[model samples]
Target chain A: MYRTLVGIGLICALVIVTVFEVTFPIIKVNKQRALENAIYQVLANTKSFSAYHLVGNNNLQKVTDNDTSDIYACYDANHSLIGFAIAAQGMGYQDTIALLYGYSIRSESIQGLVVLQSRETPGLGSKIESRAFLDNFNNIEIGLDAIDNERQQPLELIKNNSKTHTRQIDAITGATISSRAVVVILNRSLSFWLPIVAKQQEPIT
Target chain B: MSTKPGEIIVTGPKDTDEFIKGVWAQNPVFVQVLGMCPTLAVTNTASNALVMGLATAFVLLMSNVLVSSLRHAVPKQVRIASYVAIIATFVTAVDYIIQAVSLEVHKSLGAYVSLIVVNCLILGRAEAFASKNNLKRSIYDALGMGVGFTLALLCLGVVRELLGNGTFFNLSVLPGNFQPWVIMLLPGGAFFVLALWMLLINRLKQGGPRD
Candidate 1:
């Protein structure tokens, strides 16, 4: 009886392990495809370029594209620099909210901010993904302090005290921690990438 | 081994006490400390807690019945691993169903749906009662436990949502400009609410073994 039981147990274990191993690769492939599709959607209007090659292994890259403000640098069919995308991240209450900002090298400012992922509370912290909130970044010129490459004035949201067309965003009411987290992450990411972007750009008048 | 369903001896509390024990008494979260992940992870809002509780209850019911029926054949040494695999299969089934039906809710709940495999409530039921009792008794125990868990999650969800967002299940009850306490939605909020609940329940119980 003992020997029979052990044999059955081994068989069951082997079957389970084999099933998982067989399905693991397929699962990974599906997840990767989904992620790629999401990123492509965020980086809209990619048809203007001939290529969309990933820049580095870090998974965070500065890309240049046209008709976009946050563009860092993009290349034409002949490998010429067109625009750039500045990627930034901020800490939210539950998880880091990654933003893909498209900046135009020609325009020299942020085009728009797209929230990639945030684990914030639904109906509350999730407002960061809403257009009403993200619209705040549209066409805002990247005006960080040139001295030591730090921002002169950090971007923030003043809740219920909206000043229209200012660089500041209106913070989501009652979600100040989450709101500040996004601001801090956005500022920090932009700050980190500003120097790298400056190094890549030619001397602009 | 030959005992029929409902024929096994029940040594614990009789009648409604067994049924009511889980409410806040032998509450799975506060008293027994079972199902910690769901309680902590899903109680961000009232809606998530409700769905999570129902899902867990379904899994608990099925696992209890099956385990009780098969307790004799499950070899003693490998029972733990077998029970896990069984419970995980049911959890995976639930996950796919949820995903197929409501993509939005699935997105909100995220990986917590899969983490149900490790929920201690199902495993505890399997070990404590299912392994000893017949199928009918096991079903009753599982139902009681499920109701208990749902009630506990509901309580937590109601408090957190009302305090954090000034609403229950997204129905705004608080007046405009309530200035919600933001911490009620954070992980810290889950811990504090659970601890306070335990204290309150303890006081109510007068130091008795929670239900």
Candidate 2:
């Protein structure tokens, strides 16, 4: 039994390790490219991007990989900051929806939204990634006064095409939970990240 | 092996029943009702179901091949653990391959891809058939079961996607005014469809209570 067990263990390890080694580089490149594309997409007109990590409450330091929140700063062709792309995740109808959105400091508005990952039901909640649903993020001023660490008004979820208020976002007809999830996640992410971003506001140029 | 035509023949007349048995008689989904979790969960869309079916079949084939190849070396006492380890290696490999292939497919499959390791159908075959049979027969058995499983998933996927969303593989198939049966996309919808498929298949194979 011991010999058989050991032999099996060795074989399993060898096979798994071989497959993992061969595929790891390809998987890494795929994920890295996807994230870069998402950042560029959310922050439209972005030519290049850099990621910054929060250090000791307020200090912004450049990082390659981080477990804690790392905000990506997107720059235009002139190397001027266009906006910041922040990733946030929250529970949707079936699973957690991970998304990246661009927030413009100069205009105090959200630029765009892109779903990084979502496992919602097809033809329903998955519509969150639909172009029509995502278009809701185009140029809605959040009135962010990062100096005070607060948003002038909280984002609201309204019926599709019932956008009478500037703060109201239209939820997909059949994907209410999944649509609202984006709003709720953005709200939480903004509250947490905007303050930290404010501390080192300068030198971002 | 190269000179003999029979060596590589997939569906030779002599052993054609070996393949047909699993495709019809002992089907993993429609007849045996094995791996109900994926059958019920991922069949909401035709594309999702097709990709999932192919992925599962890939894993089944690889695991069966390995298990059959190593049958003699794996002692009876620790056979279950050995089989699980072999199965898990392939599942992880499949998961990574799928992710590398398309993040969309990876996200759609979600955790179900990882959950393939625990599938009763794969393990049951490993223990019952692959362990005892030679590689050739084992390969045939796996191919038959894999095709049967994929066909079953496609059946459920087509029915659900058509009635629930009025679309087949995300393409609109019905007129604009067709109101979809919303419940067909939910968990209850899967049970309704599976029960109906079972009733239909049972009626065709009528011979009293199924053994």
Candidate 3:
């Protein structure tokens, strides 16, 4: 009995490993293409982009795509830098919501946002991906006004489109929690990433 | 399986009956109502349903072939474990293949592709049919069942996408002025569509006058 079980296990493992090896390269290519497309979408008019990875918590280094998470510096057709595309994720209504957004240091605001991976409630909480809600992130202020290594004012969530400030994200009518969830995700992501990004401080001018 | 005249009149372990029964007589979705998790969750679009169906079928076919080939070697006590492991291997393969083929379809299917390992239909076949049958018979059975499962998902996908979104396979079929049925796109809509399909299949079965 033991021998037979071991035999089956061996065969199964062999087949799986073989399949994984055969398809690994192709899967990697597909994923890389998808990320590039998302970066382009969020950054707008980005004809190309260069990949970078942060060493430890501070030093951002340019690197080729591998297992390491990449932060993209988007460029236009003339190879001039447009902005940066950063990836972030946190808990949403249903599952982890992985997001990508473009940040313009010049404007001190986010250029655009895309829900890279979302399992929020369809038709309800899922509205975070809707154009009406995502438009909130387009050029919205994050105002890098740091005081003693902390944001002077963290991003805020408001309702009824009565936002008193630029960085304040408005909660949509139907997807209030989901909208807040995105903001919460963004806030957490920004608190960690923005400081690192601000230190690099390379203006595209 | 059925005493009827040309009405699913097919039964035998080695012949085409192994294939035919799964399509008409023993459909995993309509007749057995197995794998409701994906059947309900991802069938929101016809294209999603088609891709899912193909993935499930591939897993089923490969697992069934593996299980049947090893049936005699595996002991009764660990049979279920062996079957599950086999099914899961194929499911992983399908998941990777889908991811490589199209990222959008993979996203739409989400974790349901991984969920195929837990699907009772594949396991049930490994236990009940494949274990006792020969390799040739299992192949027919898997293909038939695969086609049947795909067709069933397509059925629900077509209706749901059409009524709910006023489209089929993302193509606009309904008139421009047609008001979409909002309920057909919700989680609740899956139950409604499934119940309707079950009703239709069973009713048709009973309505066969010459059977």
Fnat of all models, as shown = 0.02, 0.56, 0.54
lDDT of 3 at B168: 87
lDDT of 1 by residue, A1-205 (tens): 4664565456445654665665555555554443334334443433233222234532323333321323334444445554455556667888878777665555566666677568877668888888888777777776433424553545666888575655687888767777778778777766665565655455321
Q: In model 2, which residue pairs have backbone atoms overlapping below 3 Å?
A: none
Please list, in the order the candidates appear, how each scores on TM-score for chain B only.
0.87, 0.90, 0.90
| Model 3 spans with C-alpha error above 4 angstroms | A45-48, A53-57, A63-67, A76-80, A141-143, A146-170, A203-205, B1-14, B175-183, B208-211
Candidate 2 chain B weakest ten by summed lDDT: B1-10
Q: Which runs of model 1 end up more than 4 angstroms from their true locations?
A: A1-52, A55-94, A100-114, A120-133, A139-205, B1-25, B195-211
Best by TM-score: 2
Better of 2 and 3 by TM-score: 2
Report the error of model 3 at residue B107, Å.
Answer: 1.8
Query: Which is superior by DockQ, 1 or 2?
Result: 2
Interface RMSD of each: 5.7, 1.9, 1.6
Q: Mind giving the per-residue lDDT tens digits that candidate 1 earns over B1-211? A: 1112222434444643444555544667768988888898788888989889988988888888768887888888877876776787667767766655555577778899899888988999889888898887788778778877877887788899998889989899999888777777877888999888877777766865546
TM-score of chain A of each: 0.64, 0.87, 0.81
Give each prediction's root-mean-square deviation over alpha carbons. Answer: 8.5, 4.6, 4.1
